[model samples]
Target: MRRLHTRTARRRVVGALTAGLLCTFGPAAPALAAPAPTVAAPAAADVAPTVDDGLALTPPMGFNNWNSTHCRAEFNEDMVKGIADIFVEKGLKDAGYQYVNLDDCWALQSRDANGKLVPDPVRFPNGIKAVADYVHSRGLKLGIYTSAGTKTCNEAGFPGALGHEYSDAQQFADWGVDYLKYDNCNNQGVDARLRYTTMRDALLAATGTTGRPIVYSLCEWGQNKPWEWASDVGHLWRTTGDISDNWGSMLSILKQNLPLAQYAGPGHWNDPDMLEVGNGGMTDTEYRSHFSMWSIMAAPLLIGSDLRDASDATFDILGNKEVIAVDQDPLGKQGTVLSSEGGRWVVAKEMKDGSRTVALFNETGSAQRVATTARAAGLPAAGAYTVRDLWQHKSYNTAGTISATVPAHGTVLVRVSTDAKWAKNPPAVELGLDGGLLVEAGKPVKLTSTVTDLGRTAAAQVSVKLSGPAGWAVKATSPAGTHTLPTGRSLRTTWQVTAPKGTPADSYDLTLKASYRSPTGVRAENVLPLTASVVVAPPAGVSSLGDLPWLSTTNGWGPVERNTSNGENEAGDGNPMTVNGVVYAKGLGVHADSSVEYYTGKACETVTAQVGVDDEEGDDGSVAFEIWADGTKMAASGVLSNAQAAQAISADVRGAQTVRLVVTDGGDGSTSDHGDWADAQLTC
Candidate 1:
């Protein structure tokens, strides 16, 4: 029960790491049970025209219930209807939102006697068709979810469209379904493109009396390189794993999706997952960035929140017509990063109407001021241009140079167009790095990047350098040596980056500085900061944890200290209760709820950690420490009052996972209950 039913696995599978910073557990990676079927290649001849149903020509816009009300369990029909009502009654339709997509778990435990998928009667007594009628009546489209495999991602308690693709497609079209979000899960060993096209064929073959055109959305989580071949198969395709509502995850998705812009155009888009605005994980600034970036990417603007109870801020952010217009821009050209400096990004898109859309994005921790000339952003630099902040709904004047101080994780989205219709030639050279952003703590990963000249002019003296965590032994071939790149040419370079022996499971930024000279002999630089997340998996057998930069992302009262004594933790300082070795937790009075997280490479039969009060305990208080695994508290040190002896707490962590060590003040007003989780070790 400590699995999918409780937590959502948005990252890697269960027995693997329910990653994305410990979201939850899923089934172990599915096995290839048998020889894969000799699936035929995609029907190149028919695939294009079959799904090119003149629909979703501008990136399907809607609200999907899967991300927010995952199986609301009670009255799923009303839930969807409420959103559809909100879309029309609240002006969302006017803003170009047109779809209200429903997800899995809306199915019954059993299909009809004829093996037809049925809506769970208790959840949708009126049936899905009734809800579809309502949504369509409001001039909106209706989308439903299913899986290409045997079951849905949630292993939903119902059959998917795998074996009954024709029947399900017929039923969906008959019921007026307009969109289909096909997930990949529980598939035996069928090739992804094969399975998805099977359903695509199923939907296309459904004609006659129940025949209706449906937009196809492939949600295979991008592991299969969908962009390489999903051109005519679906209206949109997911380009990465799911997105969590946090600054780190959102920024990571932005970086991942930036390079996939080429695959998006008129009939199809590269979805970066759903929007998490007003979800309360990050600040409004971060949500603004998320919304702006998604719009810039031309991604499907699917709201992942309950609109019935949406805050005014959420409503405004989602209903921002100006930003939505940029996403719905008829030009259909997806935005790409124009230039990057550290964590700041300048994204630009060419509009079909001779105008250009630009966004100054900052993902740093504080406000940063970045500047660029109009020519650098591909705009005509003849005279002053009109710049309007889509989020602020205000206009500003800028002549050639456009500058703004953007808050951390915030965006300055604007449209820059002057009277002169001549836009500057594009950048002469662009730099891109390809490698696994997530690195194993002690392993080394070689990175490769390609420098291309997209403009007509040639570039010379091209050079590239990398800056990462100090002393990671990061080395790269000196692209910095003088070199010439002709127009339409590209140069590739490799960099070998090795993580330190004792790196922690956290995200690190690696900044790439690439400089070149234009045809006119002017120098230009593009700073691309790549985020490398380190996963420190516990080694085999039993081993002592080594020294790492231990800082808590969420602060409680005190800090998790190492061999050095923690003096100021308590009022007088200087008493880190290190029991047997180097690691422990210390706190201040009246509080101290801190936790330490680690990744064990393999399954561990047992884990042990010593707990004790700080050696400098002065008053009467109780300290309680606990060890948690798979979302369950496995062991505890009850309530220790004295600081003399260390108590041993052990837990059976039979699988490789993220183990958490938590220390608290025993529920009472923390007096001198400075607690410590000392010398934690794992036995595999």
Candidate 2:
């Protein structure tokens, strides 16, 4: 959450005056308030509805006009109709998608003379109601966009439900809107929860009066936990910021929603905003991964692209019935990361059929073999399993456990069932680390192992043993198999080792052995070696100030400054200045001004400085100093004006040891013409 702060109007007046007086004023301005916090309404009453109620409708799937459509020249009725027709013609509707959502930038600037909200006359000449009717005629739902704040992002944007919640809600209902995607922008200084609830209450009131069940879609961008409260006020809340048409953005949004699974149900769900699955910026493999992740997350399947002309690959991905089933599972238990190793990630979802759906996801740039055993997914015990590849629609009967080679940024989803019998086969165990081969000693290391039975019916017994040097000991363990071993069958363990008094510093190898019985009652063993070590070193000193590396120049507006070959120069103009080794400034201008220069052979671990300024004209003249690390500001001095000179301002640089300084000109239009600083210093 971002903090709230007050901006002084005087600074703007001064800057304007200075700009007018000297046509040479540069592009330097004080940092403004951070972006506002986004919040959603309170949770809905915890009453579970029947499967027949609207609440039980299949997680509303549809194409959203945000990622791709936002870049268009306009969002008019033709565009909506074209997208809707494509939804049906492309077999998307058959795949269970029923909505065509229009995101921001579709509204007029004001209300009609009759106090009705109006659509842009030029783009949406027939108004939103006509658009909704057209979409309805195509057997799909229509969603409109609005902001929870004062204005929408489009031109002719009307002040939405902010302050006039009831009026706005009534207008939306009258407009025959089926879905209302309430956004958050321009509504600064308002409590997030209150901001969302204000609109929710108004919408609910209007819904009741108008005899409509407008599916309220909260779009606060997850400033707070909307999954916890959206069900009470809206159907779904975006769990992340608006997604872009790129794999990185999609993956980031998906990863952020993994922790909110427990909040999803039949009607209510976690929304990773919308889908960029078909966007051109991502590869085909990435698109598949996107679909798989979204399905497992129980996120609303809202596609944000030009579906009217999608590629065949897009259709195949979106139409994967087996994968979609996991998303629409009646149990509604969202999947979470069980383990991640060597670019291989294992995620599991509990199904209503007393089984589990596991996905082996390979996020690496290259394809990798990913395997999982029943124990890793919290199954009853190791046993031969009937596994079906959801994507390939293939069934394989052989197994000690389930495993597959996943494609780069791809996933292999399988439904594991024990009740159904299979031919007898030997049990097997595979071991690996979650993060990497290298790990810090004494910390808990998560080991992922899969135990599987060749014959799906027989239970497999499993045990594990750890062997290392005499001084090393296993601290704790979590067993995943049915029977705990003298060592343990768990995937995680902590190790502690103490070297002898005169022992030489070195690395040691430890062997982990896992043994298990196959469904056929056959015994098998697997061994894996892990390495650990300790290094001894002496303390070091900050030889010289030039040895500290500052912030990188790439971070244009960041606090730290880069150093030149021999030593960077430091000035006290638009940039910051370091006095006594301390960097200080009011606002460090990115361009010329007051600045500091330092050379760092290598980046320092930390830097410290004292900053402050004297007030020459009492309350009129104030000074400020700021510390920057690699162009990023680490700290700044509070405005200090009308004080004595030699006042101290301070800041600590944590990561980047070397930095520059910024001094700003502050104070009333009187005594002090600029700010000053003293006693600056950088420490290790």
lDDT (tens digit, per residue) of candidate 2 on 500-618: 44444455666666576655566655555555443322124443332333222211112222221101113221334432234544222221123453423233444443343322112
- Backbone clashes, each candidate: 5, 75
Tens-digit lDDT string for candidate 1 (555-667): 13323444433232233344445543333543221223445555554456787766676554343346688777644688888878654577878888776355666666565
Q: RMSD per prediction, one decimal?
A: 17.3, 14.3
- List residue ranges in candidate 1 displaced over 4 A: 1-50, 207-211, 420-684
Q: Where in model 2 is the C-alpha error above 4 Å?
A: 1-58, 154-158, 341-343, 398-400, 419-684
| List of clashing residue pairs for candidate 1 | 538-600, 538-601, 567-573, 567-574, 603-656
**RMSD of candidate 1 to the true fold?**
17.3
lDDT of each: 0.67, 0.57
Candidate 2 has what TM-score? 0.57
Q: Which ten residues in a row have the lowest lDDT in candidate 1?
A: 16-25
